[model samples]
Target chain A: MTQTSLTLCCKVLCVESDDDKPLASPADSLALIAQERANLERDLTPDPRWMFWPWGFAWLLGFGLFFLRFGPDGRVFVDLPEWLPLTVLSLSFIAAGLITGIAGGRSAMQTRGPSSRQGLMYGLTWSIAFTGMGILFAQYGDALPDDRLGLLWAGGMVALTGALHMAGGAIWNDRQLFILGAWTSVINVAGILVGPGWHSLIVALGGGLGMILAGLLGWLRLR
Target chain B: MSDGTELDPVIHAQARLRVVSALSVLREEDKVTFPRLQESLRMTAGNLSVHLRKLEDAGYVEVTKTHQGRTPATFVRLTRRGRLAFEEYQEALRALLNPTSPSTSSEETL
Candidate 1:
C-alpha cells in the first residue's frame, strides 16, 4: 500500500493532498477500525464450547454405568448382563460422535469457506486416528488378562483422544482446547495407575466431568 | 512503508480503510470469500468491487478466483505490504491524535 498510490477523493479529498475532510475524525476512525477488527474475530471463530457438551454427557453416562456395573474391585455390583457395559460404552461414543458431527457440520455451514473445509478434514482425521487405534489394540489385545484388557482398551482410547484434542487446540490456537486435552491426558494416566475398577471410576468421574467443566468455562467466557 | 508521520491515503478513505482493517484481523494465510467480505461490511457488490479494484491496483490486496466444487468463488486477502501499511496507518493515527507528543514509534526519527 504505497502512499503515492492512492488517487481517490470524495470529490478529491484524500491523500497528503488534503483537499477533503474525513467523514470520521482520526480518533473515531481508529475506534471504528478496532470495533470492526473485533467483529471479524468473533465471526471467524464462533464459540466452540457447544461441541464439548455431547462428549461430556456421553462420557459421564457411559463411564458412570461402567463404574456401577464393574465396581472398583471388578466384582459385579449391579449384576447387569455381560454385554451391558460394553454396549453402553459403544452406544455412548456413537451418540456423542453423531451429536458433535451434526453440531460441527451446522457450524461449518454457517462459517463456510476454508473453515468448513478445515472442519471436514479435522473430523476425518479423528475417524482415521481412532480407527488406527482400534486396529492396533485388536492385534495385541488378546494376550492380556480380562481385567488388563479392559484397562488397556479404556486407557489407550482415552490417551488417543487427549492427543487429538491437543492437536485440535494447537491448530485453532485455543487455550481452553489445549488445556482440556492436557487435563484429559493427566486424568487418563491417573485412571490407568489406579488399576481396572478404579480406572473406570476415575475416568467416569474425572474424564467425564472434566469435559463438562471445560465446556462450562467456555460458556462463561462467551457470556 | 510509512514512518507514522503521514496517513496513507490508500487506506485513509473510509470504506477502503474499513476493508483493510477487516482483512488485517485474519491470519496471514487465510482468504475470505468476496461475498463474505461484502456481507460482513454491508456494502453493495458494485461498491465493494470499486474499492477492491483500487486496493488491488495499489498492491494492498490479492484476489483469487477458484472453484469450490462446481461453483466459482472469489477470495480476497491483504498482501504483506498491505499489512505493514495498515499497521503504519494505525501508528499515524495515534500520532495524529496527540500531535505535540514525542513520537515513540521505532519508525520515527529525530
Candidate 2:
C-alpha cells in the first residue's frame, strides 16, 4: 500500500489490528507510546510568554506611575497642594484600571483564559509587595513602626484590593483585571494613611502612567 | 517528519496536538480520564479513542482500568518515555523557530 493510503486506512479503521483482544496489552503498548510521545515532544513549543505579559505590565505600570508621580523627584502635578497627592494617586489607580481593561482586551484575545488560581496568587503577591514598600517608605519617612493605626489601615486596604483582584481574576479569567482590582483597592486605603502630600505623588504617577504605558504597548502589539 | 526521532505527520494533526497539549498541562500526580481528555479536546469518544489507541500502541501512554463505583474508568498517563519524547519534540520545534539558539544544530534547526 502507498504510505498515504496506509495512513488513511489506519485513520479510517481504528479497530485494533490484532483481532484476538479488543483491549491492548498495557505492558507491551506503554513503551512504544512513550517513544512516540518523545518524538512528538521534540516538536512542541514552550509556553508563550506573551500570554502573561499583560498582567506583568499592569503591575509594573501601577508601581512605576506611583513612584514617578509622588516620589521626592516627581514633577507631574507640582502645582497641587500637599493634601492633593493622595487623591491624585487614588484617581490615577482608578483611571489606570479602567484604561488597562479596555486596551488589554485587545491583546488578551490571543491568549487562553487566565487560570484563576494563578491570577489570585499573582494578586496576593502584588499586594504583599505593595504593602512592604509602603511600610518601608514609612520607616524612611522617619515614622515609628509601632504606629498600629496606620499599619492596620494600610493592611485592610491591601487585603480588600487583593480580594477584589482575586474575584475579578476568577470572574473574567483576566489576570490584568485581577491586578487592577488590587491596585484600586489598595490605593483607596492608602489615600487615608499616606495622605495627599508628596508621598502620594509617586503612587499616582506609578499607577496612572504605568497603565498608560501598558495600554500603549498593547496597542502597538495589536497593530 | 518521522526520522526515528520526529513524530510522523500522521500523529501531528491538530486534534492530536490538542490532546497532547492538554495532557502536557496535567499535573504529574494526576492522570487524565478518557472523558476529561475527550471534552478538553472537543472530540467524540470514538475519535479520541482511536487517537488514544494509536498513542497507546506507540508505548507513550499507560492506560489504567479502575472501578469508580459500578462503572469502569480509563485513565491515561504519559510514560517516562512519552514525557521525554514530548520534551524533545518541543525542543525540536523551538529549534525550528529559533535557529540562532545554541541548542539548535546547524542543519536541522531551521
Best prediction by lDDT: 1
What is the C-alpha lDDT profile of model 2 across A1-223, one tens digit per residue? Answer: 2433333333233333334432222222333344434432322211223323343444345333433444433344335454453454456555644554444443222122233244345546655766666666555444443234333433444455456555756765757646655665666466545643332333334444444454455335333
- Candidate 2, position A80, lDDT: 41
- Candidate 2 scores an fnat of 0.00
Q: For all the predictions, what are the DockQ values?
A: 0.26, 0.04
Under CAPRI classification, how is model 2 graded?
incorrect
How many clashing residue pairs appear in each of the predictions shown? Answer: 1, 37
Off by over 4 Å in 1: A1-23, A75-82, A98-124, A140-142, A170-173, A219-223, B1-6, B44-46, B98-110
RMSD of each: 5.6, 13.6
Cα lDDT over the full model 2: 0.47
What lDDT does each candidate get? 0.76, 0.47
TM-score of each: 0.77, 0.36
What TM-score should be assigned to candidate 2?
A: 0.36
